[model samples]
Target chain A: MQITRQEIAGMDKRFRANFINSLSGFKSANLIGTVDMQGISNLCIVSSVFHVGANPPLLGMIMRPHTVARDTLQNIKDTEEFTINHVNSSMVRQAHQTSARYPSDVSEFDAVGLSQYKSTLLNAPYVEESKVRIGMQLRSIQEIVLNKTELVIGEIIEVQMDNKYVLEDGFIELEPMNGVVVSGVDAYHSTQIIDRLSYAKPDASASSIRGHAK
Target chain B: MQITRQEIAGMDKRFRANFINSLSGFKSANLIGTVDMQGISNLCIVSSVFHVGANPPLLGMIMRPHTVARDTLQNIKDTEEFTINHVNSSMVRQAHQTSARYPSDVSEFDAVGLSQYKSTLLNAPYVEESKVRIGMQLRSIQEIVLNKTELVIGEIIEVQMDNKYVLEDGFIELEPMNGVVVSGVDAYHSTQIIDRLSYAKPDASASSIRGHAK
Candidate 1:
């Protein structure tokens, strides 16, 4: 089916949101953990996380317009710190529950039955149940003026994970980590390694990297 | 194992790149097709695509710092048009091959053996093998000062896909579409739908939406 801009613009709001959201394909699913000035912790599932750079160790995620109360965005602005915990297969249900619209005073950590882990370097709490957790310090926040959405960029300050998951080449084995991806608003997915090819070269045929395949 | 920022900064460059890149989890893999001023078609595999907004139908993707010549970014800037085609399982190898550094005059479509599908709605060419293809008009380009990376935002102008792949709720069935996701630089993944739950609510347990589970 072909959907032109006219057809897409004419779509029902809810239908359009879902259709447009899933059009980008599967997204990184993570529980963003944050804390307010009052030391209240907040956790929410966000799938828009993407790599911005690797040298300064930066990561970025999009936050919807602040027309409504957004505790995560507010807390990140207040404390300048947060944790991104990858949503794994074991706790996806609890992770998704964190998306519920709760009061500002209510901590999703306690509300969703997920334990929080704290460290001296950051004010935001981490999801103790998450296998791959990253502690980040707010680097900069850019308001995408086109739409009122905010692009929150953070520098990774701390990373906690099982050493066994890290390969000699430094690639973390996600399948063993049990990390999952999300589509639309509610669908969860598990990934199977489809083969990692060697670095592409203009004159060479792509070949599988030895021992990189599961 | 816990890695601190100090340790990350001190790691070998290659190891650090791999580690930091993989830390963000899986990303949406797509072939961004663009046509230069001379009408030459170009395709490159990019994993940074993410949803920005739905109302105006926007999408954003990061282009590495243009310290080197980048044909796709230059084409989008010159022509103000491009197409994002989701990479599928059947063409994963061919798609990955498009990442190889090619000269400005060389089109990955011809070099990588993928056919281009052109439409009148947009000047950019689309990948004929892709199931979900999006035609976009360049909206804005913002450079991240923290890193020299460029964020290219585009408005969805056209969408072409199979009718059966879209559900009544507007979510595209990715598994049925054979859409694939990428982790780190070279790893490709095929996703299996675990389940699609009902909308999260403060006091309710998430229940699977009927017939949405795999």
Candidate 2:
């Protein structure tokens, strides 16, 4: 079936939100951990984080700074520091719980039963149970004049994860860390490797990386 | 292990690239299909597309407009339209092959052996094999001066998909489409649904949606 924009606009509010959200395909599931100026910790599930560049190691996320993610936005603006923790398989429910509109003084980490850890570099709290945690410093914030969403770009100042998960060939095996992805806003999933292909060349067919297949 | 940015910069080039890419967790795997002025069709892999907003149904992507992805970027800019097709499990290898540096006159659709079909609303071709295809009209393109990457924003004008995959509650079941996601630049995987939880609320624990769990 083909759905026109007008038809989509006419759909029920929640239905349109769900339908539009799922259209982007699978999304990264990470908990954005921040701390307000008063030292109250804040945690929320943010699926918008995506790689911006590799050399300087920047990550950018779409945040409705004026609305939904105000706590995170305020914290990042107040402290210019935050943490991104992968929502591993065991932490899905607890991570999802972070999306609740907890009061600014209430720490989602405490309310949701996830432990907090502060890395050596950033003041933002990290999820202690998360296998992959990154300390980030605010690099820049650009607002999309279109719909009031802000583009929050940050530099990865530090990364803390188990060394065993980092492969010799440069890839980090996410399966070992139990890193999960989400569909729509609530469908959580873990992945099964379909094989990693080598760099593509016009004259050659992409083959599975050696020793990656059964 | 804790790796500081300084240490990350000192690591081998490819090692740093892979390690940093994996830090964002899983990414959406989709082929941006477009056509040049001469109507030369082009297809390329883009994992940077992320949901920007829900009301206007906008999607944004990070593109190095000056360098890599020049073809897809140029085509989208020239035509003011494009298609985003979910890279399903069966099309991963062929979709990855589209990333090769094919010349301007050569259509990647042919080189990669994926069939293309044009919808009534857009000139850009959609991947016939893609279970979910979206026709997008370029809304705005902003330059990320820091890295010369452009944030290409598009509005969903039309969506083509099997209505059966769209649930009564509006969540589109990706598993039925076999949608695949990427980790790093080349690692691809299909997902196993852990469960779909209900909306988060301050007073309750999240439970799997009825009929969505075993």
Candidate 3:
């Protein structure tokens, strides 16, 4: 099948969104946890999480235009702190529920039956059910003018996870954690480690490392 | 284990990079195909591709700071055309080899042994081995000042794929294509579709959609 720029522009609104969203393949499934000044908590599922820089340990996520009330973006701006929790297989249904539009006063954690976990060093609440939770401090925000979207960059301030999942070379073994990946807005997937190859060098064949998988 | 911000800042340089890169979980594995004005082609693996917006069909990728020569970024800036090919399990090793630091005169395609495919509509070369390929034209570029990374946004101009992989609702079934996902710098993963759920709504459970997966 071949789809051109003209055809894509002519597609139905919702159809184009679904088609374009899934074109990039599976995305990291994470729930962004934040809180307002009044201590009101908000949890929204986002799949745009990507690595930005490692020295400062920055992670970036895209936020849609504020055509409606964007509680998660607003909360992060006001507090400058948020938590990114990996959505696992067991909590897929509950995590999907967080996408529904709830009232400003309503807390998704309470509405969806997920617990809020607070760390001593960060102001935002983390999802207690997530096996991998990261506390981040807002580093920068860039507005994408072409589409009114905002790129939110945050520095990883704290990481809380099981020590068993951390490999000797600093890679996190996610298969044992049952970490889920999202396709489009509806599909969820579980992954298996095919292999972890050693660092690539010129004129050298990539070799697999043993005992890296948990 | 709990890693605090101070501790992360104090860790060794290479250790921190690996730890922080894998913290975000799995990422989309893709080989970006680009060509220079002289028609010299280049292929490099990138895990930073994220959907910017569907209305404009824009996709964004992060380019690390050009502390050293960045052939991929330079080629895209000069020509404003590129192709994004989804990496599959069969070509994992060759895809990883593209990440090696090859000099400007050396084409990774030749060095890594992948065929360059060109379509009539787009000037950039695509990977013939890839089951899914997207042709894109540069739309915008924004400089991330804090980290000196560049966010390159491109509009999806053409899409060529096997017709069977696309679902009725526009989501592409990746498992049948043997698409691979990358974790950190070296790990590759194969995914299994747990289920495709219907659109979320308030006061309702997410039910699986039948006949969505191939």
Candidate numbers, best DockQ first, in rank order? 2, 1, 3
Candidate ranking under lDDT, highest first, comes to 2, 1, 3
Whole-model lDDT, model 2: 0.90
Task: Report the C-alpha lDDT of model 2 over A1-214, residue by residue, as the tens digit.
Answer: 9999999889899988888999999999999999998889999899999999888899988888765479999999999998999999998999998888877889998999999998768789999999999999999999898798899999999999998888876688898678899999889999999989998998999898946522
- List the TM-score for candidate 3's chain B: 0.96
Q: Name model 2 segments beyond 4 Å from true.
A: A66-68, A210-214, B210-214
Error of 1 at A173 (Å): 0.7
10 residues in a row with least lDDT, candidate 3 chain B: B64-73
Model 3: residue A186 alpha-carbon error in angstroms: 1.2
Docking quality class, candidate 3: medium
Give candidate 1's TM-score.
0.97
Residue range B80-123, candidate 2, lDDT tens digits = 99999999999999999998888888999999999999999999
Q: Candidate 3 regions off by >4 Å?
A: A67-69, A212-214, B67-69, B212-214
Clashing pairs in 1: none
Better of 2 and 3 by lDDT: 2
Given candidate 1, what's the lDDT at residue B6?
Answer: 97
